[model samples]
Target: MRATYPRQDPPRGGVRSWWGKAWQRAVEEAAYSEAELKGGRTAARRGEVGGISVDAGALLAAVREGDDAWTVQVDVPVLDASGRRSLVEVVAAESGRVAALLAGELPHDLVEHAEELGVELLPYGGELAATCTCPHYLAPCPHAIAVLVQTGWLVDVDPLVLFAVRGLDREALLSALHARTADLEEPPARVADLVDDLEIAADAVLRARHLLELLESDAEVPDSLL
Candidate 1:
């Protein structure tokens, strides 16, 4: 089913409201003008964030598949650092997937985990697709909305912090893989060269001994005593 929700406007008291503070910080970090944040909010109110809108039904389907439970899709507006706007389609998964997708693209590891859990991410194309099995269909659907709103508050604290919830955890995963791959490779070729050189020296010693014995026999003047 298709539904629309009004984009939330930034609170008026500048940075007083959580979203306002987030917008202010994002603007500062992005080096974008205050005018841009205002413009972005305007665009978001029109239901465009990162150039896509979530399809409620499709999102619900993906979330249900992932969570192994039933859920309804809800619509919400989101704005990115660029001030571009789009509708975020969210569903409640077991937990946190919605947060990850909404904050940014899903990390490869998170995607892999979702797949392992038989959870499918709906087609977003810059929109968010979230899943929750609860039956609410409102724009935020209460539970899902709670997550989204909290996510916004979190962004105010540190925009990138959303990545942890989304399942990226890249630093730990990469370090482990690097250590494993290093262990699998051979030590080095220097050990092999040392072994070869030892064999050659042993052979040379044997050959020199044979040559000396032959020379002694050829010069056997001591036999005249017999």
Candidate 2:
């Protein structure tokens, strides 16, 4: 799903919000000067970024500065199976965390545990590969920086954006959660108990075979029993 930049003020969450903090970290990690980063933030806040398109491992945007237009591409790292599993396990471990994430809020503790497990739910500069058509030597021109910042805004409105950039789309994440839920709802069969049942079934089969042999010698088999 595509998340547009919000025209209104963000949900009063700011840097305290999970995505905001993530975005801040990414911007801070950039080699850009403070003035340049501030300009990019201004552009993002002013809604100068548009035509946003998000797919697995990338976010595309059209950034407008005055009459000049620039194309920005932000490469998000997709999580590997182990990383995805770690995230699911962390989130599914707590019902409240699941609920909060479903409501478009990133639970702080959940993110912390995920980070501990080596799963990055947020965009670190190392994971945020960026490029722009603008002539600036910086990897992220101001326009691209704007889009990256707006990405955080998108994450705020939709926590799934975090997964989208991290490599799991919203559907895949939800599907994983469903699988986790199904696993939780369904009790696992005990190997020892199943083996015992199989043994009992085998014994019953033997007893039936012996009885059939005896019946065949003593009397006609009953069709009703068959």
Candidate 3:
């Protein structure tokens, strides 16, 4: 399912977050050409890339060069189900991670915890699948690279952009965490609940006995009864 589009404002801070820097470095190292990387970063800085449509495993944007425009998309592999579950569990394990996420920040420790669980929350250089609609010979044309660079800005403002690319949206992530909170806040099992559970077990046992009685013959006792 497509996640809600993340709203991004330009970073008010003078420098990108450490996580954002990591993302940029990963992208830069993966790119085959430094000229393409420079061109892309330049376009992003000049606001040449329009609004990006962020999705699970995909990022879509239009990069404009003067009168020319081309559609660019970067495909990121979605995290597998096991990794996503581990991510949720790790985030829920720490109260600080939960609080940081709720406060619109991605905690440094959260990423580290994810790494411990064998989940790479950020895409490395080899993982980027960039393509462009423009007829360019470059494997990752300047337009596509521009979109990728523009995405780094979004990461700077809100690091959850990484999650969206990995098949989970920010709202869904928060909702999952909220469910964990609810579970923690849930009242402990009461005496009455335990009694009810015992009664259910008793009923199941009686039904099993009745079924065995019907199936057994007069000459033969079931091994369970013996």
Scored by lDDT, the top model is 3
Clashes of each: 14, 1, 0
Cα-based TM-score, every candidate: 0.24, 0.72, 0.75
Off-target runs (Cα >4 Å) in candidate 3 are 1-14, 181-185, 188-226
Q: Give the better candidate number (2 or 3) by lDDT.
A: 3
Sequence-dependent TM-score of model 3: 0.75
Q: What is the lDDT of residue 9 in candidate 2?
A: 36
The TM-score-based order of candidates, best leading, equals 3, 2, 1
Off by over 4 Å in 1: 1-126, 165-167, 173-226
Is 1 or 3 the stronger prediction by TM-score? 3
Cα-based lDDT for every prediction: 0.34, 0.70, 0.72
For candidate 2, which ten residues in a row score worst on lDDT?
Answer: 4-13
What digit string (tens of lDDT, one per residue) describes model 2 on residues 1-226?
A: 4544333333344645656776778776863677768888888778888867888788888888889888889887788889988887897676566556555577788888898999877776766777988898877777877887777766766676777767677567656766655465455344224434544654455466546755856866665445
lDDT of 3 by residue, 1-226 (tens): 5533333334445336787888888778767798888887777777788888989899988878899888888889998888888888887687556445534467888888899989999888888888988887875777777777768877765677778888877666755655555566566345234434544654465456545654653446556544
